[model samples]
Target: MRILDRNIIKYKFSFLLSCLLLLSGEAFSEQQRVSLRWKPSQGAESYLIELSEDRDFLRVHHFYKTKNFRYEFNSQDSKFYVRVVGINADGGRGVSSPIISLADKFAAAPKVKVERPSTVVASSEELRISLGDPKTSGPSSNTPGSPNSQKQVPVSTYYRVNGGEWQRYDGSISLSQEGWNEVEFYSEDILGNKETPKKTKYLKDTTAPQVRLIGEKKGQSGLIEIKSGAELTLQVTEEGSGMEEITINLAARDGSGAEVNLTLSGEEAKQPIKISSSGIDGLSILRWEANDKAGNYIQSELPLLIDAKHPLCVFAPTEGKLREDGIYYLKENGLIAIRCEDPGTGSGLSKLEYKIGNGSIQSYQNPIGFNTGIHTVTVYTSDRVGNKAELKIKVNAIKPDWQKTGSELQEK
Candidate 1:
């Protein structure tokens, strides 16, 4: 027998497995049946088939000799590299065919498409996915068959959300979580070839941002008071999708109003938002509005009283006469008291307190009486909106004039 040229045998071996690989696995089953066929080569009496997990074929998994040109086997999610060699009449081996991988003969991974990046308020999020291989064709490809062509008919698909149990994918999936969502999916072809599992993430924000309004002081009747030219600020926060915008609507008692929208980006968003009280005074309303990236919104209103004057309090003796030196000379059994007043358009008086020298402070509900001694008194007062004042007074109650006159008469 003439020795065949190495290049010629290699070229002839290339066409030896014409349309040799075919996958005929059961529907939705793990056991897959694969079929292989080849053309007869000249001067060959039988064929040799080799299967391995490695490309170099150093670790051969299976070897078989047959006179026929077709073979069948069952694969349980196993991939292989295959080659064919020709046998001479005298039992000599010919050049081997080029290596081929079962992976190239299998379908690709499934494709997933999200309808929306995130769910907004009153809106639904839909997820659409396909089991067909993107590499073979877009979806459910109908490509023609050839020696190198691969069959990519997808049979079943499975998916899980947020680490839940695996469920068969039949239709669109809905996302309902408040924030980011985790999803995993995979598919199997008719050849029982399982695709590598894939993971994806998306958002589902549906809550609005939160806002806090801060003022100089708060008092009874839900009133917040601030001084003229005082700067005010608001604290805005978001839990999902982040803050998108902040707006302030200011309405004054004089029927004038203004609106301002804040920019939330870079260094500007980090800075405190100051609402100036430069020209507007008296009672005014501040309306705060905030929104998140998912279109959730919230609004609130704050009532402010802008006053520049401090409240005033006075001390007097109920049963005594005021002397020229601003001191009070009390008669026997005399009492002292205090009074507080507010300036024009100011918050009303809230509290009054007094204390003797080095004594604990007491709320002034009634007149105060001192012992038979010269004493110093300190008084504190405040208005409804935190305007405060203090006063100190001297009282002479050690020896009343009436008591002295009685003593002098007794001496006579």
Candidate 2:
């Protein structure tokens, strides 16, 4: 019976010792670890950890974790509970703290606000817009983790002119004309937060085209002469807007202002105005009036001197002896050089007028071919500037070896 009692006491003592060891192991394990850990769910990798006085969602303690969390809590304060939730990532995940105490505190979530562009002006040429802070009316502070913050949101602008199509503007866009217009702008942040639509209206177009003349003055006389049976010329030009047409009205006037009108036509053409008469010879005034399609005009006048006269040539012999031989022959080919000038002061010789003996009146510049004989030569000259001269010559062609046949022949 004594052995049985001793064995029973040993067994009881062994059981109590095993219980103490198990309890101590559990206490040490609890001291070493304070929180739970798990792989974050999809879209919930980055999380915000919140501490509360209790799990009832009543009095919030602090923002425990603000960045991506591999949660582990080591705190030594009044016992508190925490819950963690992801903001942007996708997941049905939530973690809560088994009430604990911690020495360090967590920061709270930052407050968020938005800023917009001020006085955006829209035009057909350009859109001028500026951004300012909502609080200070200056550049918005974009510091990380700040409450009043903004991202340089990629914005696309669109424009509609008087209910026209909305053209998208990637950066800056220009307006086309001067008037009121509506503009709509869209902006989105990296976090998928979108701004409300912005709109405005403004004026545009502040320029004009330059213009000038390419040719001479209006109504100016061209470098052309006017005479009976002659053609007149006129030149006109316009620098800008191009030359479309030129109309010219030409007229012939007598001393009494009685004029006959003629029409000339061309679209930038070098036109020739014609004049003719029915044998009445007198001074006439030729006038030309010109105008461009742009309603510009100019007038000019030229004095037309007219005369009707036939040319005549006179012949004169130089100081040379005539041969006594009935067949006159001299040492050299003697010439009856003729000088002809126009007799009419207002008309010109159309060509050099000449005649040899009783031959037909023709035109010649140099002397005509002459044989050893008594020949008569005449020439006439005339100018359009009202000038004339005439000359004639008699040539006694003789052989170099001939002498006077008789004194009567020489005297004659």
Candidate 3:
């Protein structure tokens, strides 16, 4: 009785092994192998696999018998209605898996694009790259319930730097050093078919552009004379990249300023530029900057002083003057035309003031009319830079009856 009971328990345990479960399935391209795996049966001796077009095996295409819990297909099988059945040595049958399709399980490889900048300044530190996938009109064997627009994910990924050993890539990576950096990368499909390895070189630079002032810049005080609306061009040299932008700034000694944006097209870009100093005067600054295509940039500046030259006051009054006295003697109704001129400061001459004898100072407008009896006049002129010049002369405006020459009216 005891022996019979032990044999019954053994048979029950063996029967349970037939309830093995079908697990995962993987497929690659038509040139690669496909894999199907299942959970191990507890005490089963072997397993049976079938590929078909229907769940009931009505249109079975292939049959497989093996001792292990897994099976594999070659490049020949396009699709499968696959299932696995467990069997035990005691002639027991356990569970059977539901129907499955091993069709359209592979995807195309991922495409990659890389961008590299070779400027020494304001450039990215990483090796810039973008990913892409092509679209084609075709048929596939993916899951029926899944979306058709899903992207592909690599089963495995790897990379190499500077012809070094290949390493598994967990995520993204970067290039730390400047200059040329060589890289290689690829990924694998579910069936372990690796995509073609891609190789390329990336250029990295971090140097600023070289800048030099182009015009005649010669003076002990670094002095410069700028005309209004003048464009000052500078010679710029760049390595590893082309030019991008240029900027100029003019400001007063008190930090007041205006900025100028320069055009980089039209001419060869090497031609001289006119610097505009119109309406600018006194102590100021001339600053310039240059930028390279890769974002590298540099700046240069110098001190500027405005000196349009002093205004000249010509006291050539026609009313009265001894050719040798260099002084004017005028009648009460006589007129004196005043001329003030400045050729130096870019800034025009501003104020002109004069006084008649002991009268209050008056801003000069047109010609002057003299007062009677040996009047003294002082003329003052100022330029844009605050330069002032004064000339004094003695004049006498006598009444018509006074006869004011060297006679009695004292016209001096």
Best by TM-score: 1
Q: How would you encode candidate 1's per-residue C-alpha lDDT over 294-360 as one tens digit per residue? A: 4455678877876655678766787887789987878778888777777765767878888899999
How close is every model to the real structure, measured as TM-score? 0.43, 0.26, 0.37
Q: Tell me the lDDT of candidate 2.
A: 0.39
Q: Tell me the tens digit of each residue's lDDT in model 3 across 204-235.
A: 44556576656645333356544434555567
By summed lDDT, which 10 consecutive residues of candidate 1 come out lowest? 119-128
- RMSD of every candidate to native, in Å, equals 26.2, 38.1, 26.6
The Cα local distance difference test for each model comes to 0.60, 0.39, 0.53
Once fitted onto the true fold, the runs of candidate 1 whose alpha carbons sit more than 4 angstroms away are 1-157, 189-194, 215-217, 253-267, 308-345, 349-412
Q: Which model, 2 or 3, shows the larger TM-score?
A: 3
Q: How do the residues 1-412 of candidate 2 rate in per-residue lDDT, one tens digit apiece?
A: 0011112122101111000000011111332113223223334434445556565758654543323222333222125555545544353434332232222221111212213211112111222322211222222335478554663433333444445676654333345544344555544434454445555443321221122222222221222222334343444443322232333333334434234556544443333333443242345555555432222234566555444444556443353444554322333655444455445434545567778788888877654556676776666665553335565655666556666565544553
Off by over 4 Å in 2: 1-228, 238-260, 264-284, 292-294, 304-311, 316-337, 347-373, 376-412
lDDT of 3: 0.53
